[model samples]
Target: MTTRNIESTDAAGTVRVTWAAANARRLARQGLTAPVDGGPAAVTGAMVGAHAQVLSAAELSVALRLDGGATRESVRTALWEDGSLVKTFGPRGTVHLLPSADLPLWTGALSALPAGRNPLPQSVRMSGEETDQVVDAIADALADDDLTVDELTDEIVGRTGTWAGDRVLDAFQTKWPRWRQMTHTAAHRGALCFGPNRGRKVTYTNPHRLLPGFTPLAGPAALAGLVERHLYAYGPATPQHFAKWLATPVRWAAELFDRLAAEGRTERVEYEGGPAWVVAGDTDFPAERPAPGIRLLPYFDAFTIASQPRTRLFAGAAYERALAGGQAGNFPVLLIDGVVAGVWHQRRSGKWLDVTVEPLPGTLTAARRAELEEQVERTGEILQGTPRLTVGPVSVGAHA
Candidate 1:
């Protein structure tokens, strides 16, 4: 693929860059390509974390990074067996598989803020005092033993009050623990994290016990560190986009952005006529692109979901099809040369894994077509299955 990186500064101190449309493919490849050779924790550190609401998606997300070097079982081992990764609530109040050692930074930065706006009306919401009590109850209950959500809810209501047992939220087609909403609160506060599964049920434990002598940064320090990490991986973004991705208020994101700019930690640039920020001194725009290939990214894979400015990544009808409802994780995406090209799905028949792709017609070259087939086999290898390939639409994901 022909690639170009153009950069210029006008006298008024504004930066402008225009890339041939193919540049979109190159820039994304730069950002999304994983250092799979670096292992699971390295992959987690690079992408921040894997969207883990679906355990299988999280496993596939990390396993795909291996580029066939590892499998779903290897990723699971890292998270459960090796203790190198931790499943916890990260940005946007979602569960993610983050590096175990990064808990201090992740929790310190996230919990410094309050839990999200309650979907329930104010009358039914947990009060600040009650919320704090729930947090305390969670920390206390899971100090020595991992407990399922039901068990923890029982303990929490018992410790706090029967009022805490009232239904407050619904998710994943079931009523969550009244304290379930606060579980994210507990996670952000570093009070709770995932334990080995108790059969089919998910369980929670205290991260403190798993990671000893952890020294969490103070609020401001952690915020700065968090922003830096984000910019390092996904920068040249506006504060508003940052806020949206983090699910924080724009004022909060802007305030942090201002601080980073003031500290010489980041610089402003124009991306498609809009001003954006990047880590200072991080302007490395190489002349050539990485080897072109296809990646069948898992649902909510960091690359597919986290990158922003829809115009930059999606072109023409590709955007409308790839994000049919403007939702990212609803389908596994076919990323050709980094930019999203179409949607895909897989089905299992005994040991055989049948894969399907719905491309934007003419998007795939003979070489990319070959790479797409290779990616299908790689997907099965990562999932520890065999592979078959078919092109065209296939129904998949929860949205369908």
Candidate 2:
């Protein structure tokens, strides 16, 4: 629904949203400290989708949220055995483990969004029509069976012609055929989803196979639903943040935010940087705050990726060390008191997980130190492993 315009609220009045409060609100809203009890799907739903570029990271993302010390085995069982979660392309063409039941909202909202502006010059660039053709070809080719990237590429080129294969994307200091790039667009179009792995190879399948009678959101009706969900999880947000999170153009994101406001589903509020929007009646700041705890967030956790501003995430030099490229997926972060306090790494050997924490040159209280131990123990329990920690100052900055 195209909303006329947002009602004027002069929101940045009376209620002051300090950066710390914004962070705290987000921490509570994301179900980080107090995860919902509906199993992995619930955690995934709250997160929108857990980044799965590295599969284990995705599993831990859910494990840390569920009750009863959920483990990676549970995530595996849910995906491979239970069919409750499906891996697919999320915002920015990245792989994410999405709740199977929510495919309609994801595909519908995603497909409606704009494509990336490829200004890579003609030699390596693809035209808009070519991209669309590739997306359609993929949807048709994968109608029945799962296909590896090679198999899908062959089918796609066969249908769309060899020109579709001529374009290229560069990564790891090497140029690769561009056919793989269309996978995200294919996913956006509901044409492709991750199939169970074949040995060491990753494969793509039709999401409909897992979600019977699945269909893209019947227009923006689904997108409107997603807007509500996004705001609920990461409200007090600006159009730019939503745009970045969805990988949609800023203009398009702004349009969606405006539509929500026009519908009275959202209201303006005074946020740290500027005025922002939140789900209506969400102005209840300090609503029964959840006590803060230590959490070790995996790379690209939705919590880190959702909001745009980082001032609240990091205080000073910590921002530079934690987010050098202004990207969230670079490394795992340590969350203490609802802010990024350090970085950590895990090495699992047999039944024990060797954890190394590198803080931002600060000291934890005696209580916090004990709490950190408890948190590490919990992390081990969630992974179904034991914790052997090496706690000391270490360099874990983005590049380090």
Report the Cα lDDT for residue 364, model 2: 59
In model 1, where do residues sit more than 4 Å from their true spots?
1-6, 12-14, 17-34, 114-116, 168-177, 397-400
**Per-residue lDDT for 157-250 in model 2, tens only?**
8998987776477767866567666678788778889999999998888887898788888657878888888878787788988887877789
Clashes of each: 0, 0
Best by TM-score: 1
**Weakest 10 consecutive residues of candidate 2 by summed lDDT:** 1-10
Residue 158, candidate 2: how far off, in angstroms?
A: 3.4
lDDT for each residue of candidate 1 in 1-400, tens digit (9 for 90 to 100):
2323545677756555443332443234333454355678778877778888887778887877665578888888888888899998888888899999988888889878644556786756777899899999998999989999889989899899988887756677866556666778888888899998999998999888778767567778888888877766666678987887788889878888998889989888777677887678655544555544677877777766667766556677777877757766777888776577888887789999888888888888876778888788888888778988999876664443
Off by over 4 Å in 2: 1-16, 166-168, 171-175, 287-290, 395-400
Model 1 weakest 10-residue run by lDDT: 19-28
Q: Residue 179 in candidate 2 has what lDDT?
A: 66
